[model samples]
Target: MEKIEKFEIYQRRFLGNKLKVMPLIEKIIESEIKNFNSFCDIFAGTGTVGWYFNKENLQIITNDLLYSNYIPLRAFLSDEEFDEKKIEELLKEFNSIKDCEDNYVSINFGNKYFCNNNARIIGEVRERIHKYFLNDIINPKEKAILLTSLLYAMDKIANTVGHYDAYRNIKDIPYKPLKFLMPDIDKRKNQNNLIFNMDANILIREIECDVLYIDPPYNSRQYSDTYHLPENIIRWEKPELHGKAMKFDRSTLKSKYSSKEAAKAFADLIENAKCKYILFSYNNMANKGHSRSNARISDEEIMEILSKKGRVKIYEKEHKEFTTGKSKRGDNKERIFFVKVKK
Candidate 1:
């Protein structure tokens, strides 16, 4: 797990929650990247799939809806140069000012997390870093790396069931990797990779690459709902705050990506994917099927959609640490769809 460990944020992200499909993703990527020259991670959550190509000197194009994700993709996967001293200075300044003021950080999640200090420090630091990023006050690559590191750090400190809900169970645990989170950041951000913050629907045939890895949310449960505080913390905008800082109006609801229309749209999007190989990561959750929300879709429906466009193969792996209760583990077996065509 050495290589996997290097992607620390990926594992930290699933702290107490369940995410069994990550290993299957590793398997397919290991096999596919062996022959590919470039990759396009359409829904690049955490940009873990793109990391596999970095060693090959291959170009990786990553797109995500959250600006928070763009920072890491640009820093680790794309950029080459950096300014260590400036980042260190920023880090020092951030820590020095961390406890002085609460501002947007505390307003968003001070009460939800057990580590109130963690949320407060993270908010202040994120805002300061973004100020440098937005005003072109510092090197873009440096800002990206700093913000990315901070995100990792803050996530480490956050409590609750992985997302933004208040921790009902109080655990006397300390956030490790504090040094990495509040790091001696760089001043110059790497810009070798192309990154964008946009709705997933905008992707089309024009974006070309050797492989496309799609990991859109499978169920109606929205990420914004679970991770609302961080959304505000990362954005640092502190928009008219509401109940628990949830910007519900701005959320890309489950209807947008979990509807019958969404399934057809996903098929159309995949068929038009400008890649030789396309891998879709999804689980048999409620509504995953064609009939209803959280309703699992059948393989036949998926195969029929892809048959006309390319060759299709299927794989399945049981999720790790699934609840033993018969009702819980029933839907834990996740499935992967590998659709490829000769280019």
Candidate 2:
């Protein structure tokens, strides 16, 4: 089989609002009367938007609660140049590891999310990557790149649609062999590039940038719950899981964005953001009759919070939401709030 050249193949598989609003964001950036040197993605899900800005010579700072997301951010946003030969050699070594029996993912998730064979392979590969890190064989950036490769590879062959909530009920699951690929490293280096794996609320207080882009969860769905399997693979701590979804204890990873406190959290973020301009991407999915109709904050609430901080302008574009179950497709619109902070 021929190799795919698309840089966003893995990112396209991510389960969230990403990449779709880039053109609109770019337009906003151009028109918003900005002179920005540093860009911050406070809720960098897959680092897609931040990476987009990084290419435009902005010093990028990306933060996410999920450990899985941090891996890719570290790999893509690093200032250091990576040798293609070294990356290829690392991939070769990772692929060469034989699938072992009863590894963490295999023992817990075998015959559940992935088939036993694939699960075993995931476990073995994870172990090898962990071992490489422990033995100091690979540097921190190299470890991130290799782990990100494995994460993307596993995502490709996952039996679910995009998330790890449930696996498809199939008698004979498709056995696609896992293959690691080199991530498209951003060579246009910015010395101040930073990545963080912390709660957005806490992180916002410490970082100050010229442009702050906020893309928090719109509904009551916690990302840690949705992407638990990937998080597990990233942390590699062999956590104690529970319930039908086989989720680990994510008590520490829960976001206020998914709770009744969401409005307050949004307000706090806006207050704490040290930026000239703030852009927020949110969807009008609250009134849409769906399982996730329980939106954390209303549009009016969001507008009210943001208005207190600055002069705000709203942009709207129709978007097709990817949903499952008995959710009917309807008119979906993504709203971007461009705010000029009050000096």
Candidate 3:
């Protein structure tokens, strides 16, 4: 294995990741708000926005339904104290693991989402991680950091088109040895950071911050379906797998924002939000692709819901959307609806 430095959370290929437009988002917030000490990313998919702001020393509160996203968010943004030197030593041990065991990941996902060898190793590593946590070898924060490293490593070597919807059909899947890298995060404890694995709409009412950034799913695609493999690995429930895609039941994790109820959900979220400013990210890809790929909430509905809250200003930047080789590509612009909340 080569001497790798560290893995940035943005390095992983995630659907709807805000890595490219992060600068634009920062600019909009910086220009609009004069003073804000806390930022809440309620629909923090990859924790990209929340993690980015954490670097700037703003108190960050992040919420996502999936444990896959929650674990990484905790790793990157949690202020809990951890031993960096011990974590580094554990990374070396996790990477040096050789003996592969036939376990849930190997039996269900072998030769599909991952190669046989890597799949077995993945199961082995996950089991070890749980054992480490169970026996008090690592704290919750430390466990998150370790699990995050495994998740990123799996994403890199998965045999799919940047998602877990389906794997490529071939006689032999590509074999890449499973390895862990240190998650690129500050060793110093971040201040006043909070993490949640909860539904965004329900969560919005309970949380308050200076800036509430909402980047809900724009289309009908459920993140649980798109990233189910990662969810399965992160949860480790080992439930029954179904279909060629090898997904477990994820009914509870579905977001209403991705359904026909998007407008209603958005309205409720806005009505209950307690914040000085609202930054809503929605793309102009309505009715552009197949029915499932089309945007659920309409522009009129968004404006109507937001107008009741406060004065709204719109910002636009042309950006390409991530597709799973199904949706049609066209002129798309990611729009941010910035609103000054009425006190």
Of the candidates shown, which would achieve the greatest lDDT relative to the real structure? 3
What's the TM-score of each model vs. the native?
0.79, 0.94, 0.96
Q: After TM-score superposition, what is the CA distance of residue 320 in candidate 1 from its true location, in Å?
A: 2.9
Model 2, TM vs. native:
0.94
Write model 1 residue lDDT over 172-204, tens digit each, in one string.
445433434333322232234566666666765
Candidate 1, poorest ten consecutive residues by summed lDDT: 1-10
The TM-score of predicted model 1 comes to: 0.79
Clashes of each: 18, 0, 0
What lDDT score belongs to each candidate, Candidate 1 first? 0.60, 0.82, 0.88
Question: Using lDDT as the measure, what is the rank order of every candidate, best first?
Answer: 3, 2, 1
> Any idea what lDDT model 1 has?
0.60
Better of 1 and 3 by TM-score: 3
* Candidate 2 lDDT trough over 10 residues, lowest sum: 1-10
Give one digit per residue, the lDDT tens place, for model 2 in 56-172. 467899989889888888988877555567667768766666657787888898887888888998888888778877997777888887888888888888888888877777777
Candidate that beats the other on TM-score, 1 or 2, i.e. the better one: 2
Q: What's the C-alpha lDDT at position 59 in model 1?
A: 66
Model 3, span 115-171: residue lDDT tens: 888998899888988999999999999999999999999998999889888898877
What are the C-alpha RMSDs, in order, of all predicted structures?
Answer: 5.2, 2.2, 1.7
Would you list the clashing residue pairs of candidate 2? none
